[model samples]
Target chain A: MADQPTPFERFIQGILPENPVYRQLLGLCSTLAVTNGLKPALTMAGAVMFVLFSANVIISLIRNLLKPHLRIVVFTLTIAAFVTIVDRFLAAYMYQMSKALGPYIPLIIVNCIIICRCEVCASRQSVLTAAADAVGQSIGFGLALCSIAVVREILGTGMLAGFRVLPASWPSWTIMVLPPGAFLTFGLLLGLVNWIDAVRSRKKL
Target chain B: MEQQQPDRRMRLRSGFKNSNLAQAWLVLLLALVFGSALAAVQVNLGHVIEANKVNETLEKIPELVFGADAARKLKQRQVPIEITPGTIAVEKDGRKAYYKLFRVTRDGTPAGWVIKARGQGYADVIELLIGLDDRAQTITGIFVLEQKETPGLGNNIGTARWRSQFVAKSTDRPLVVVKGGAKRPDAIDAVTGATISSRSVTRIVNRTIEDLRGRLIPAKIEFSERHG
Candidate 1:
């Protein structure tokens, strides 16, 4: 248990124990904003994955050369560079999706999950290990976002991704698509995760 | 040993001498790289973005003027008017017939036009394409474009049933909206729920006609014969 985990273990930990949104709760603002629909959520998740993975590998490669005092500044600069690249790439190719996500895409620079991984996992670990950590964490983040989107989209519009999933008779809840819906959905999901963790712990005891 | 100690101190001082300046230089270099990259991207996409905006505006204008095929042959020609306010003028074969201008923006920008004899409907503002005969001050044909009132009650503005009433109405006299239906040559029926939207359309048409007779006819700007 004390030894470093294998690549597979690292990946699993990303979705559960080290979950960036639920377990770690490092970055939640963009998570809530983009989770209004499946498409926006998926796009944001992909952008975050790309930036996180690239930044981690680069940080690990230059860890030794980076002075301890200037480590935070270097890590931030690396993250910002990767975020800018992703932002521009999306704007050039997937212009519509970029417009839908708007300012949140660039705000990924301040996403603490990316910076945390750089400092804790990438800065000390090998490049391969850092890459594994990035992939694992990204998967976890994606799952969290998709789960929230599913509930919000279903109740808000009585549809799934734009396809009507609910019956015509069903009354649509307009509030689910608004700001309050984001808070309610996130709070409920957080509570459910905590409850499940507690029950599982009790069974073990 | 004492000489060696002084030499070591000199080396340590040299190592820390310009660290602040080096840090500042590093920051400046990174900023320059980022700034240039952003400028290049903006220059590349600027024209395409502008073209898309213009196309969107062109598409909306015609729909707001005349409904369907009537506006199909409509061509928009930008005319410079000295009124200092934005307005729309209708013409046929170089003679001005009908014109209307309204403030769509608070900053004095023209938002839309109301043409004479656009038709009467239940509710909502009905936009029209007004044209006149070369020698006559009266309007020839008024094509109804768009309206938003009540669906079943006010939507009659767009229907052929309510619109056909204006086919032969004389433009020499002002049009009026009546509760049951207009008995006069220049009157039309107003929908029950959408009386306000219907009245708004009638008022716009009347005002536009007045503007055409008072100002546009006397002005040097000539209205086009064909709608564009």
Candidate 2:
């Protein structure tokens, strides 16, 4: 019991040690689908943050009441409701951005990251602890999406969010913006994060 | 194992009052609450969402009629562009397909025509607002209104460079998509690796121009073109 991590430690680990994308490999569908451009990736991250944080808080509050068999059902219903509201809001207010994101916003329901966090942290932990976990995981997810977007957008279009970051003459790599670019970037970044983790652990030993 | 704990706590013989026996009440409660929330959202925001789509197409009218740079100048100078919406039933292949038409005029003069057209693309329906000169003799521009084609490949149909091929091409001949560079008149170069998508757009534009040329001679178009 004494060796148990503090709530803050649990929160802190999600950012790097238990990153949903790189560390746990959860929510890769959106990570790959939206990372071709920076704007869409950021928008997706924002929506996910809102949904994940809200779901975590509500689930943590009602943890004791949750039936064992009906737990997954509740998570799905809650998430679907949040995602529907988000989709409509985006369509109404941020129409262009919503168009760019397309069906990916609705697809956030199946993102595994939120569900995994709910089961692992919110279902057992205090409300504050679950919230901290949500925030931390959201940041980690955002970072992962941003990194992939930056790499793909720069190499693919020689631009970031419509601004030309590279020279005009730069021949953009066609593959970088394609769906395969997502897999390529994900593989390399995953390797990089793992390698860094290994070095830090080896140093401690 | 966790399911057994609920059965031990059940005191009521009737299943309705007992929380453990009536395990699905929580789900029913959550569903009702969430469903109501969702219904409220849809009722309030649904119209705005539909309006957003219409407004998006309206905003693209300027760039579709005039060139992009000219469209910017028109905005700066406060040149009022009028878009009169009308629908035209054009016979496509074997069936009758209707296309929404926008007769655009700058101030009091007929500038060009923009037609809303859609066709089957590689993965999904691709909607385009195609622009043509007042006489419907040549294409002015094209703007993709909605598309869900393959990312990075078929979706390039929306890019300015690819769409530029249609501009100034004569309406006398149906447009043809070529493999590489299209030096021949009435021929468009296909988007590399997206031949199907490229062909789809070409088919849509060609079919639209052929059907519209004879039908779109508005009385004001000729009068306005001759005088101003």
Candidate 3:
């Protein structure tokens, strides 16, 4: 299509227009599941970013050798391999965090963000471009997760990263820590992003 | 010779209508190669994974048996475990669930017992470690090992505030879960939205204590006394 965007533009695009979570809606399962607290949300984001970066670099380097008929198969195999490495590494090094994450780490195998990046960008672009996109999209996805976690943790427990934020006099909202809270906060944040975009486009016109 | 037909060369073509055997073989080969690579990694990391798992359990033992502050006291002491030959059976919903009990000693003296317990919770089997005092008369602490309960509701059983209720609870009678509020020592307040899970945990802890007390504790006490 058009000439590839500069790396800076690509990074910006990932955070706004083509965000894997909020804009593209690629990896909603994890986006919703792990954002209840700061630690889990951050860990999930790191795992996704690592998988995406590695998979993109490798896939782009070998894109020419990939046969059209076997492209999806190769992509999945590569993604699964990277995911396992991350899972084992976490279990060994960050034992408690690995335990806290539980099944979510292994579930990264099926995260659509990494697979989507491989198909859309990595397969068609240079290694450098693919790597840039991976980093950008990962930050976008991580930001979305962190935003939700910040709200939930503060409102639900009156704490942020285990430190008290709200005054003790303020009544904590217990529902904010539950499953429904995830949906409510995410929905509101998505709407806010859309609203801001609408205002920016109108000003441009 | 004129009547004999010339042999025509067959071109291998892969298209939409025709199946591509070469491509199929390539896909299979890719899968096989990658699968072997994954297997190799797993085999190499197998020991590390096993050791981490055992360490995870060992690391939680002291904290589960003692409060956070007191758990550090166990650092210098080697916590020896003595496993019992038989398992304890507890009935819930017409099914018999079995639990294993282990005696935990601090420096060759009996200090406590950590029972590996399980019960049918709301959605899945809840596994936990129940730590009891030396006499097996009071529960020192409880730690949930594994659970597949409802995320926001039943899963709250794993939180510290919920588990702390079991600390120093006497095991003379079966513990009960109270929905409104726990008014007595033998009763625990059920999690706000997860009555079934809270009840299940209490029942499992109570059953383990009942089954292990008579057979294991008295014999161990006599052995420790004679050794002293």
- Highest lDDT: which candidate? 2
lDDT of each: 0.68, 0.87, 0.80
Model 1 C-alpha lDDT per residue in residues A1-205, reported as the tens digit of each score: 2486766777789988989999998789998888878888889899999999988998888766666666787778778877887777777667657756879999999999999999888888888888999999999999999999889888876887779999977776756766678889999999999999999999999
Chain A fold similarity by TM-score, each prediction = 0.95, 0.96, 0.95
Give the docking tier of candidate 2: medium
The fraction of reference A/B contacts recovered in model 1 reads 0.00
Candidate with more favorable, higher DockQ: 2 or 3: 2
Candidate 1 at B167: error in angstroms?
Answer: 19
lDDT head-to-head 2 vs 3, winner: 2
Q: Please tell me which model should have the higher TM-score, number 2 or number 3.
A: 2
- The residue-by-residue lDDT of candidate 2 on B130-162, one tens digit each, is 999888888999988888887768889999999
What DockQ, between 0 and 1, does each candidate earn?
0.11, 0.74, 0.47
Worst 10 residues of 1 chain B by lDDT: B102-111
- Report how far off residue A23 is in candidate 1 (Å): 0.3
What ranking emerges by lDDT with the best candidate at the front? 2, 3, 1
Error of 3 at A18 (Å): 2.0
